[model samples]
Target: MNKKQISILGCGWLGFPLAKHLISKGYKIKGSSTTVSKKLMLAEAGIQPYIFKLGEDNNQEIYDNFLSESEVIVINFPPRRIPDIINIYQEQIRSILPHIKNYQKVIFVSSTSVYQNTNDWVTETIDNKPEKDSGKAVLAVENLLKSHSKENLTVLRLAGLIGYDRVPGRFLANKKEVANGQAPINVIHQDDCIGLIDAILKHNSWGEIINGCADNHPLREEFYTLAAKKANLTPPEFKKSETIQFKKISNTKSKALLNYNYKYPDPLILVR
Candidate 1:
């Protein structure tokens, strides 16, 4: 049997590493980037490189080749922080809807921002009520993809990503009067993110929505302070608040369904 070919739409921070990992597991990877320079880099990393821009004019044959040859398509790009992102983001995904066949599985990399800060534990079943514009854009795209092809789609809703270069220390280092001091944080390391996605593909888990987060929920004040300290940066000062708003993302579905174990179960330990 030949190795399965998987095409990743975005070869940025997460996608780049993911492609390399998949390649190590004996799978062929076709990775895309909008940048011309990164094309050579991806090729060097053993990924079939393609220059794919969703809303812009792309080489139709190249784009089709990127989408057509893969057994699975991983849509891993994030919504841009633009004024008209809500409409533009949906349009970007919409452009590729026709090319995606029913047999080919899709892993839409979503975010946990789709859930509101209910100050309670959130699971897959809860109705999405995103509070931020970015979250709203993600939710809209999720709906679009599900409606377009629900059977082959799986939405992996990841929490705030923190690992490798994305040190939480720099996020609030030396910051004054940071809000939500007592609010619980929901974060997953890069290793866990890759692991979760691998499990999905290994098990052939499709048509599901899974939340990928660390098992431990640490307080914002505690986690960030330690993270800054660990990075040799000035610890941020948190403002005292009577009310704490937070959403603790649950990984029950992923753990149970994927039979997976988190590499970084505790964010506090991650910084320490």
Candidate 2:
């Protein structure tokens, strides 16, 4: 069988590792970097690196080359948390939709933030009511991808990613008066993300919306405090209010459809 050719946009935190892993699995990986300097770095990792920034001049040809000769394309481009980008981030992502159909499959890397914090368990079928700007932008991208492809698209709404080099403990270390102490956290490990995507590709699963998250749901205060201590950092203090608000993201759809066994099921244990 011919090796699977995969083009990954935004070879940053998650895409970089996924590229390396795919290479090890005998897949030909094409990666995109916004900066020219990173091309050497991507090449060193055994990825075919291309430099292209969506919504920029001369990007059409660059995107054409990047999408060419690739059977699967993973649109992992994430907007940086800048106000301007987050505001029009959907348009930035939509700019590439015109060039995506050449590939046999597409993975639109999205975020679980698309689901409003209804303080209820989140599933793939839940009604999306994004409250934050980031969530709204992600939803718009998801809709754009869906509109473009009926049979070849897979929308992965990833939960807060936590893994190597990403010690979540420090996010609010020593912070005081944090609300939602009892709220549950919805996070997935980078390892699981890679594994789930790999499985989906292997199984040829498309036209699905999957929520990539861990199986366990730990309290915000408990998980963060434990994470902080594990990293030898100061624990954050949460407000001891009686009001409890939380949402536990469910991964039943992805697991059942793909038969994926999570490597880091319980984030509380994976903090180390």
Candidate 3:
């Protein structure tokens, strides 16, 4: 079978590695970055790189050329957290939506933050009531894609990404007082995240909202204490709170829908 050409928008942390992995498997990958420096970086990794920005002033001709030869397009940028940023994000992505019509698949890298802390298990079926700026931005973008893509979008709401240089222990290593220590953490290893994306493309599973997370939900205190210890950092102290605002994110849907198992099922083991 001939490999499908994929265009990756915002080829940063996760997207860059995914592009490289796909390339090794005989897929032709075209990646884009906002910085000119990344052009050489992507090219060095065998990706055809393009530099462009999304917004009302976007150059249609440039985006058309970038999206022209691609069978798949991955929208992999994190939503802006600043206030009044959703409109900007919407403009950016919606501007590119016109050019993605010919693509067979459109995968949007989203976040579990879109789901509010309901003190219960959250799934794709639950209504999204985002509680923060970042969550609001992501949820808004997800809606835009869902409404305009004619059901051709795949939204992967990934958990707290813990891998490579982004280990969780270092997050609260020197922190004095941390809130929500008893809250359950929904985190996924970077390796499993990439694996799930690969599985989705292989299975041709589009038109779905999937929660890309791990099977285990450990308490924040226990998980972070260990993560800090492993990194040889000062462990954080959790207040003695009687109330626990916690939610355990279930990966049952991702496992069932994608037929995938997480390599980092136990986050406590990540402390090592």
Candidate 4:
């Protein structure tokens, strides 16, 4: 059997690591970056890097060529700087939708932020009532992908991404009063993120929304206090009367459907 070609959009941070993992597993990877400097890195990692930018009136031929003849497409890019994030993502999805071939599996890297700030356990079946601008934008793009994409689409709603030099210790190293110190932190390590994606690709799972998060839901102060102690920093003071709110997103669907186990299930494990 011929090896499947997998194309990854936005090969930076999580995407780059994912591409490297796929390549190490003997899959052909084509990745994209907006910057010219990262092209060399992508090439060195054995990924065919395409520098594609999304906008109205942008060249479609380039995108078409990049997406051509691919068995799987992973949309991992985000409009980080755009003010009208929803419109930007919508246009980008529309531009790429026509290029995707039928029957190809697509994984849209979404976020758990789409769920409202209610202090309840959230799952794939939760209503998407986003409270923030970025969350709303992501929800819009997810809807667009589900409705318009020709391929079988699956949405992976990830929690706060951690790992690969992004340690929690540095976030509050010298901070005084940090907001929401008592809220439970919803985060997942990069290794588990890649593992979950690998499981999905290996199983050819599609047409579902999977919550990609760690099994552990530690209170913010407890985890951060440990992280600070490990880094030799003082733990930030938490407001005693303030109620920190967050949604504990469940990964039951990912575990049951994909038969995948998390590599780093606990948030405190990384600090040790």
Candidate 5:
């Protein structure tokens, strides 16, 4: 049997580590980076490096070479924060649609931000009414991909990423009177992020939307404060607020379909 050939677009924080993990599992990796300097790093880590910036790199040949013969494509880049981002982000993904083979499967790295603050638990079936511009961009791209080729795509909506270098302790450390203290946080560790994706590939789970989040939702104040103290940083202070807005992301679909077991099932586990 032939080994799987996986192409990862935007091999920065999460994609870079994901490529390494997949390589260890005996998958051949073709990874992309906007920075030409990172070519050596990716190659050393066993990734076939392709250097090009989406939207700016108009060379179709580079994209073709990067995507050629790969069975799975992981679209892992986040939409840039800017005015008129909905159009811009949509265009970026749209540009690649023509290049993707009809048989190839895509795993789009979406975010929980696609769901608005309903102060209740949300699943894949909930209608997306995103609150922020970034969320709007991501949702637009999700729609674009689905409309383009719904059958070969799987959207993995992740919560706030924490683990390894992404220490929750540094976020709002020594901050005074931060807002949304009472709101419950939806977060997942980087390890679980990789694990969830692996499970999706292993099970050949496609043509679905899945949420990848920890099992437990911790109050923002509780998790961040404990995280800061664990790192020996000054804990942030949160103001008392009666108005709390939050959306607890549900991972039931992922668990049932992919048989995924979150390595860090609780946000507090990272701190404790």
Candidate 6:
């Protein structure tokens, strides 16, 4: 049996790590970066790096080649702050969809922000009423891929990603008066992010939306304070305020269906 070729769009941060892991697992990786400088790094990591700018000129041929050659495609691009980011994403999807016709699988990396802040528990069955601009745009792209793609599509709605050098303690190391200290914080480590994708691919799971978040939700103040203490910094203060509309995200579907276990189940465990 031949190894599968995987193409990762927007190979930065999470995408780059995913591509690297896939390569190490004996899959051929073709990754895209808008910046030309990143090509060298991708090449060094044994990835066939392609320079693909979403809105740039004369780049359709490159994207088409990538889409046609890869057996699986992962779209991990973030929306830019254009006046009509949703429309732009739609256009990009339309452009790429044609080339990915023969691909066996497609993974759309989406955000948990697609859920409206409702101060309740949210699951895959909940109607996605995105409250933020970026969330709305992500939801639009997800719908476009789900409705139009002929291939099996898997949508992974990830919580705030944290790993590598991007730990939360640095975010609040010296800050004071952080809002909503008592509000529960939801996050997933990058290792688990890649692990979830690995599980989905290994099982050939598709045509489903899975919430890719850790099982734990700690009060913001407690997590941040512990993070501060670990980093040898003073814990920031939190003032009690009116609760913003937010919900505890449910990962039951991901757990049941994929049989996936999160490596970092607790938010505070990462700091300790």
lDDT of 2 at 31: 98
* Better candidate number, 3 or 6, judged by TM-score: 3
Best first by lDDT, ranked = 1, 5, 2, 3, 4, 6
Q: Model 6: per-residue lDDT, tens digit, 211-235?
A: 9888988988888888888878877
Q: Residues 98-144, candidate 4: write the lDDT tens digits.
A: 77777778999989989997788888887789988889889998988
After best superposition, candidate 4 residue 251: deviation in angstroms? 0.9
TM-score for each prediction?
Answer: 0.98, 0.96, 0.96, 0.94, 0.97, 0.93
With candidate 3 superimposed using the best TM-score fit, by how many Å does residue 15's alpha carbon deviate from the native?
0.4
Cα deviation at 168, candidate 2, in Å, is: 1.2
| lDDT, candidates in the order shown | 0.92, 0.87, 0.87, 0.86, 0.91, 0.84
Ranking 4 against 5 by lDDT, winner: 5
| For every candidate, C-alpha RMSD to the true structure in Å | 1.0, 1.4, 1.3, 1.6, 1.0, 1.8
In candidate 2, which residue pairs clash?
A: none
lDDT measured at residue 58 in model 5 versus the true structure, 0 to 100: 72
Tell me how far the alpha carbon of residue 205 in candidate 3 is from the true structure, in angstroms, after superposition.
0.4
**Total clashing pairs for each candidate:** 0, 0, 0, 0, 0, 2
Q: Tens digit of lDDT per residue, candidate 5, span 159-263?
A: 999889999999989999898888889998999999999998999989999999999998999999999999999999998766777888998888889988877
lDDT of 2 by residue, 1-272 (tens): 77889999989999999999999999999999889899999999999999877888678888888998789999898767778655578778877878877446999889998988777788888889888788888887788777888679998889998988998988889899998888889999999999988988988999999999999888888899989998899999999876876678899998899999999889889664
Q: Which pairs clash in model 6?
A: 117-245, 119-246
